[model samples]
Target: MRKTAHRMVWDIFLVNMIIITGMPGAGKDEFVKVAKSMGFLDVHMGNTVKKYAYENNIKIDDTNIGKFASDERKKYGMDIWAKRTSKYILDEDITIVDGLRNYEELEYFKNNYDDIIVIAIFANEEQRFERIIKRNREDDIKSYNEMKSRDDRELTWGIGKVISLADYMIVNNKSLEEYKSDVKSLLKTIIDSRPKIREKLGL
Candidate 1:
């Protein structure tokens, strides 16, 4: 189809860039929360998929629709989401992003933004699966296997490469207090390490 060709061509034409990656329910959102509370802004890529799903009346429970939203993104590239989220970055002093799963998406961002940070948050597979089942955003997924399927789909979507190339990693496997503490500590380190963060904000 024409759509598929566009995605392949876009990938070939675009440069690969930095991105933070992890499976669903890995506290990518929570990390964003910590960042925002500490003066950083937050944006989520999944909002793009969710918005497309909503406009088309694609029930969150529709696995096929989720597949379509993801597939359609391959051609135009996830920068579609990055472009939207970029608007928020301009409105803030510091920013953090949630829901990255492909290198092309990351590249689109790094090429446009300066001093971008790619932080990956991860937990054990079992924990992430349990978290997804409980989230139950889609009634279609009610078992361990169903959650596994979602994760596998993301992996196939190029999530692994993003994770492997991350500049930093956070493993979420402890109490919320501990995780929050780690976030603060890690963020401070990243801030100190990246001059772009301070330079852009005039800090």
Candidate 2:
């Protein structure tokens, strides 16, 4: 049964997943926008968390959502979000997963899928805080103190370690145009190199 189940998973998953992770305001959403424009489908872990909160009659604010995600991790193990998110991805050639939070989730994908590339976006703390203030998303941090607190919580979950181990790194501190151009080039490179990646993976 275990062998059959593993075979089922192997048969269901075909192609590479680019898992994107970064600090709260590190422009991962912007990177996903660029990837989507280049015809990549996206699965946002943040959206998964938000959906769960909505279905459970929980408030969708940052604090509530943060607590909810943390509680679920505590209950189901550190990779709970990855397990939940993986069910939504089917046989897309290249899917991007945004908002990865920890090393456990990274490992879950690596162990199950085997054909995933991890990308980490980087921005300085001041720049990230500035962007967060400008975006004002429903669950975005409002102030530097709030951002710092959120950063602390995420780092505690091993996000920093995951970020350090990414297969690719993109810095997002420059102007929007420059950042978008860089992202576009990288996506094209990844798409073009798919055959080589597949060969390396023995796929």
Candidate 3:
């Protein structure tokens, strides 16, 4: 009976979801990390990129990869990577998606899931660039040219279009406390709506 109860709880966890989006270094990762600590299951699209890249023999940090992805979407249509990311949403109470880089991805999920919500995080370009340098991951970029190029790629690929269309926007220009405040406020609203949303959408 206990095991069956656990399975039932786990199944409920599987389907709740929200997509977190922002320009590079807008603190989407940090926000998602906090969300994970709370109750949301954070899913980074980069994981899908790296995994799919590995499976397909494509380079993970290849120059022009973002552009390539955009072009591929143009040729192949929406949700190539989205389909992979969606898999992780199963069994998680709340799935928080990070790094939404195109409008196509937004529409795909929005069309498929009636309860989908896009949360846009934003910071000044200079602040975001500085934060990106601080992360210093393998993907951490150095030159302004490199960062600019990637910025151009995402911008041209309609990343901003989705960001601008987001149902909620959090401007993360100050300390984490300020960001947390916005998140908490938005989360309360989302929490309150959960019953209605679940019933309306059959989640």
- Highest TM-score scorer: 2
Name the weakest run of 10 consecutive residues (lDDT summed) in model 2. 1-10
Please report the candidate that would top lDDT against the real structure: 2
Candidate that beats the other on lDDT, 2 or 3, i.e. the better one = 2
Q: Which portions of model 3 show Cα errors greater than 4 Å? A: 1-14, 62-64, 196-203
lDDT tens per residue, model 3, 143-189: 66777887887787678888888888889988878877778678668
Task: Give me the overall lDDT of model 1.
Answer: 0.67
lDDT of 1 by residue, 1-203 (tens): 01223332222212112244688778776677777676676666667667767887777763765576576777676556666554444422455677777787788677665446677888997878767766666534667777778777878778888898888899999987899999889987876776666554455
TM-scores, in order shown? 0.79, 0.89, 0.81
Q: Which digits, one per residue and each the tens of the lDDT, describe model 2 over residues 1-203?
A: 01333435433366478999999989998999998887777899998999989999998877899999999999999999998987677553567899899989988888777478999999999999999899888988888899998999899988999999998999998999999999989877887788744443344
The CA lDDT of each predicted structure is 0.67, 0.84, 0.71
Error of 2 at 104 (Å): 1.0
Candidate order by TM-score, highest to lowest?
Answer: 2, 3, 1
